[model samples]
Target: MDQTRIGTFIAVLRKEKGLTQKELAEQIGISDKTVSKWETGNGMPDIAYLSPLCEVLDINVNELLSGEKLPSEEYLGKAEENMKHLMQENQNNKNAGRWQGLVGIALLAVAVFLTFGLSQAKIGWYVDCPSIILIVCICAACVLFSGCRTKYEVVHFLRKTVLPAGLVVMVIMVPALLHSLSDPAAIGPNIAVMVLTLLYAAVAYLVLYVAETRMERRRKQN
Candidate 1:
């Protein structure tokens, strides 16, 4: 459900009742700031105020909660069905993210193979260092993603595993990059490896950000 829409509904209801926020708060026994927060979608009304708020607005609790006005029985039934579909879609998205993480690991494995076999003959030492770091990162990400399915787990794993791994990779890769800048022969491959590793790190951070945002919004809803 959209909290913003609920807030908009409340604002409209307040306007219809010809009541300012202060007046609404006075009638409902809440602070004006609480009413403002509800109207602005910054927060939800407390459970104890729900019934009284609806009463003052001359609307049903369901309508207030749902941000809809006396929806027909058939419409309510269809909305419930749509909500179930949305839940299923959310589950599918979570599964797809997991699958994508596995795909990333597979790609990292292939990169490791190519690094050891092809790059070893030309840039053996530099390639081995970053390759090992990349492998560790990919493995750690996969393990954390697999073992921790919830938001808390995701946040903890990112803080304790992903961030540290990324910092280590950067620590190793950065000096190698700086050293390679003095040698034209080493510059191309060094830059390419750095770019790829940084890209992967960025994607990992984005995934965590999205997961955490969804979790926070869900937390608010509950």
Candidate 2:
């Protein structure tokens, strides 16, 4: 879908209807900046606002989505095209989400390692370090990947066996990491930690996934 074309079409139609950005936004129950964002191709209208926007612009949903005025004959074709674009966009977003899940686990491993592994050193007190950043990154990534908004939900998801399993791996890996870090010729030093962490992570995730699926099934039966 050509966002710029759609934005321009929206701007032109608004003007043709003798409405300013603010007037159009007021009619559609959105802020002027939101309308401006659409007009500038910086954002698209929310799905909730699409119907209202179509009404105000005197256009059909297909036309608005297609970013062009359509003849009666081309309307169905445009609708199909728009549907394909939406599906492809959805697939891309889900793929990006998978990447977030991967990163979150990797960061979780690093955070657990550095947070505890560094204790073996001569440091007296724990201060700010890269591990803090790792934790923060993983926390933010978890919210995005898991869609867990509430604190309780996030905590519940993290405090399950998945985290404990990771911690166990990290603890066991620490002695190996310490020894390897000291050896100049240690082949692929951190590989064991990363592999064990990822292995445990995969197992934990599979267990949690099966548990959730069963719970969902039980809910449906009840």
Candidate 3:
């Protein structure tokens, strides 16, 4: 709906409010680059940011979406239309996420089934190689399909996934580590890999926790 026009209107509103891009971004808990993108029509603000963005710009949602101020008589009708559109978009996104989750689960189930069948058939590398490929494929599919729409949602997803992801990493690597230690030639490299992987996973969890905590603090402050 005239994204360029809306962007220009956002810039105008920001200027009218006597706020710099960085200042507005700080108030809204986003980066200056993100604010610039919104003002330049390179991207739209996330739906989660819409309310705070409108607040900081001293405008209402209808005015923001319409790319201009509206008279009192037109306000209700325009706002209603915008709200309907927003609700539909939200519903579509939710449905897409549900489908993605289901597909991911199905892929994992298929991978498990195939691995079991191959192993039972007494195949050597056939079981090992295809299982690895299937696992990798499932991971790629999940990464592509399970994208979050906003920074907060990303942080939330990370927080929820960190424990399970860390556990999975350890479960896969620990056994390999033990197996490697049994081989004299591979001891040094295996130890190094195991240590590094564990350290990296720990650091990832720590960073995610800190970031999520900070976001929570900011939300409470606001």
lDDT of each: 0.72, 0.71, 0.71
Clashing pairs in 2: none
Best candidate per lDDT, number? 1
For residues 51-117, write the lDDT of model 2, one tens digit per residue.
8999988998889989999998998889999989877876775587579678978987898688778
Candidate whose TM-score is highest: 3
Each model's total of backbone clashes: 0, 0, 0
Instruction: Please say which candidate is ahead in TM-score: 1 or 3.
Output: 3
RMSD of candidates 1 onward, in order: 9.7, 13.2, 10.4
Q: Estimate the TM-score for candidate 2.
A: 0.52
Q: Identify the runs in model 2 with alpha carbons over 4 angstroms from their true place.
A: 120-222
RMSD from true fold, candidate 3:
10.4
Pairs of colliding residues, candidate 3:
none
- lDDT tens digits, residue span 1-222, model 3: 567878999999999899999999999999999989988998877767888999988888788988899999999998888878767766776687579668967987888788877666433423234234433444444445678777776777665665455455556766767887768888776565545444554655676776786566456434
